[model samples]
Target: MANQPQDDRTSKQQAIDDWLPITSSRNAKWWYSAFHNVTAMVGAGVLSLPYAMAELGWGPGIAILILSWVITLYTLWQMVEMHEMVPGKRFDRYHELGQYAFGEKLGLWIVVPQQLIVEVGVNIVYMVTGGKSLKKFHDTVCPSCTPIRSTYFIIIFASVHFVLSHLPNFNSISGVSLAAAVMSLSYSTIAWAASLRKGVKPDVDYSYKATTNTGVVFDFFSGLGEVAFAYAGHNVVLEIQATIPSTPDNPSKGPMWKGVVVAYIIVALCYFPVAIVGYYIFGNSVDDNILITLEKPTWLIAMANVFVVIHVIGSYQIFAMPVFDMLETFLVKKLHFRPSFFLRFVTRTTYVAFTMVVGICVPFFGSLLGFFGGFAFAPTTYFLPCIMWLAIHKPKRFSLSWIINWICIFLGVLLMILSPIGGLRSIIVSATKFGFFS
Candidate 1:
């Protein structure tokens, strides 16, 4: 070991030493900091409300509420464990913890793909969201003009993202970030208010009931991916721990878990109401983007759209940055591409362009959200972290049935597979009906 070169340590290994400390002044209290984390998770979760409402209606719309209970329990347990594992280390990326907990190979396979999904999904989301927001704004501003188009807006927004991603201190957009938080709350509150005003009752008519029946089995599993994806952003713990003061005596005891818990609570409060109201107002008719259900004033919809657009952009960067950092580190070290400025630009531009194309081709949030949630996030969020916990801790006493854990994992996997298919079918059918494919 002494014979090894100093530069040989991997980035993952280096990050462990630079881990941020957890101190009162360094880390914000749960009250002040939790909403940031919570809102990010809710961003992805809220996007799927319209779709979930359409399939399951108000009865199973409560599935989101139910799932929050299960997710909270699972999250609390995970936080307890994470608090023990990651105090002093500068946990920059997911794989650092993965490598520390498990071995390198497992970390590479598990963390890498998961991060990719998050980044790509958020990018696609930003494009779709920004485009939609721009479309709405255009319509509001020029209701008499020809149908408002989104081509130019997409380009402008994408350009801004590229520029914003490169800024050093442009880490958080305070106003936009705050609006994302507030708009999410507002959207949910308004949705609930709308439901109450409209008197959204359960359909008692036999034909209405039968047609709306999302089979119990399908609803049970199908909803898992959506919920999993919605809650997957909890790994923000990696970022949260960075600002805390790291000391040996106080290393493990920190406020980060409090932040995580607080964040989850805010998320639950914001998302549950929105899901309930969404299902209440539209019943099975809710589209995937719940914003479509709003028969509100143009100003309100436009405001909501603006916030959603900014929220998507912020999310896109969160997922995008670490991946970019990892790739840049690899390229500079291995491929010798670090010396050239143009090469760096080319690399980033390529990534930006790829995301753009994906966003354009897959314009709808409903299908994209489902597919990403089911396939990518389900494994990372629900299954992988728990697996990592078991692998690292090797807890001899799990009184809780491993049977339930396995069942959750199996159901997670199944939902991931089904959400995409069902979501895509819904999109295709809608598109065909609208003459886009016909």
Candidate 2:
């Protein structure tokens, strides 16, 4: 096996890695991490927090929300610290880090599937979110115009990716990411401030939304999934860090962690108020999307919807860039296809179309969030990094790090198991009443 020239293989591999989207650039600044993380962590999921609060009620809801924020932040720090743990080497992709912690093959099996689900699931949900927000904007602004089907609006939303997908690298989309970060903060502000302005609804009920014991159990589980879905930035942290230049003295972790702190603060600002205030205002009567609940101040609501459309546009790209990198890597390496513009066009277009079709079939945004959140996101966001940390760092037994990692893993496993049951049931219940492509 060690017969032929080894240098030839190394050179060929480096060439392909350099060509891949995630690794094509390494000059990004720390603030790039700041806004990109913002765009990634604070997505359409935040809009669902009020409904989640309603399901779990105030006590459990607030507790779960705060716990998730802390747990995910700690796990994220593990990822950043491990990024350049082996000086003179960088684990540039999630799967690469996975391969390092686990054996090469097992790591791919463990991480890639979950990572793909998080990335692709997010894209599918965003497709529905974008289209629905656009429809909301249209209906609010032009109430008298002919009504358009959500199917068409979804297609219109997918059309943007047909163009933006060609941007070729994460850095290329910095402007879009920055704008999305701003829009997220902006719309999040509008959501809370507008609700504050409108004041709480009359006879607001703080009781759980579900009546039966079984129903309450399911809803509580689903609420856990919804909160799990909100802190979803870990999937892309390493990929985002790959863009930042690193050196032995000034490792990437310093800047990456800096950006992550800023992003998390922004996340806290966006998530806490929206979840707490939105629930306080509308109580259990809140729509799955809080924006859909608010009706007054027509122009303001319309603008918020418009802002949602813009923000998801950027979020979609942030998530998709990694998927694109993976696809291109597989094609160029395994299939031996020459990398070209045509290859990228076909791959990205096919992906967009596939997500659009799935989104069209099941446009239940809330249920999808809970389902994907538990089935996919819980593993990737909540616990996988901790698992990776223990495997790589071998944190001292009985130490604080060891205890914390185990705790996260235990909670994450419970989240993965319980939340999916409720999320799946919710999807089935919603599906029974929903007409295809309507």
Candidate 3:
């Protein structure tokens, strides 16, 4: 009879999770994993690759691009493998996995804040990305049309989310995510192909654009952050895996890894051509956004911008679903609010509005990428999984696994420290030049 209360609590908690956005479904297919990862990873950050390469220069730029691909794939693999590590216990969320690796309270403290930063930050950036792209598309298609303020475009973008944010779970958004994946690939192809056809600029300068040593050093730092931002999938890897069903014979990891491999390949296809070909074509003079740099092909660039809008629409939801889960979980579980359509509607709408407002207020695309990328993306996407692997498995000292994990840790930490400095400086400078909502 005494156990009845505990059992009641357990049942109630399970019911709450089932009602929540992320944990409500677990029947997603391998293909669902593929596109969701694609949507989540190949986002606004990809649009900025040539810009990043411009800041990085040739050798270091190419090297960093390749290295980020390898390291993030490694970290993503670790996340997929660890999703069901504790036998029947599956980590349905990033924070849940953190709780397992670091214990209940400490795990929440360490992981939740960083995970929130990555997810929320992505949503905010995607708002600006979606809005700005829409504005670009309008301008490209109708140069004579009255120019719309970016703030209004941003508002139009957020209006879509206000409705879509009510999607109950990851499974519900699969179609959107699939379309998003297609659009991402489509736009990325357009970006690089167009850049290639444009050919190298007349007297293209490959030299670093910075006039001073300090400027060059800081640009290098900001470039690291930009690259870090491109590989932002690790933040959502576990959650993406959570949607897939698992069994002893057919573990989720098998299919999740397959999907991830496909997704990473797509990521490479999208990232490399845009970063390399676009940089090769434009060099240090590349616009922070490659699409902006390609102006001659009006119809094609306009279409690419539309594709960008559609892709980020899906990408925004991919990232926002987790934030919805977090907020709903907190409200229902901690505050004793009853879970219902009203609660969810209010919660999700509020979140979408919040991101939209912030995005409109500070639409500093390049600087936002660098700041959030280094401050949050590096730790979560680059090294946190390695830290978790070591903590959980305790691999033997000085072994290959041990050595590699430590190397990733060292690099990730360095990235975390340096990238923000440059990003912040850029934001400050941009703020001085561009007034709020200007």
**What local lDDT score does residue 225 receive in model 1, on the 0 to 100 scale?**
51
Greater-lDDT candidate between 2 and 3:
2
Point to the candidate with the largest lDDT: 2
TM-score of each: 0.79, 0.96, 0.96
How many clashes in each structure?
Answer: 9, 0, 0
Give all candidates' CA lDDT scores: 0.58, 0.91, 0.89
Whole-model lDDT, model 2:
0.91
Measured with C-alpha atoms, the lDDT of residue 308 in candidate 3 is 92
Q: Weakest 10 consecutive residues, lDDT, candidate 1?
A: 16-25
Q: Please report, as a residue range, the 10-residue window in candidate 3 with the lowest summed lDDT.
A: 1-10
Deviating ranges (above 4 Å) for candidate 1: 1-35, 44-47, 57-59, 76-80, 83-90, 169-176, 198-224, 336-349, 401-407, 427-438
| Tens digit per residue, CA lDDT, model 3, 40-119 | 99987898899889899999999999998999999899899888887657888998888888999999999999988888
Compare candidates 1 and 2 on lDDT and give the better one. Answer: 2
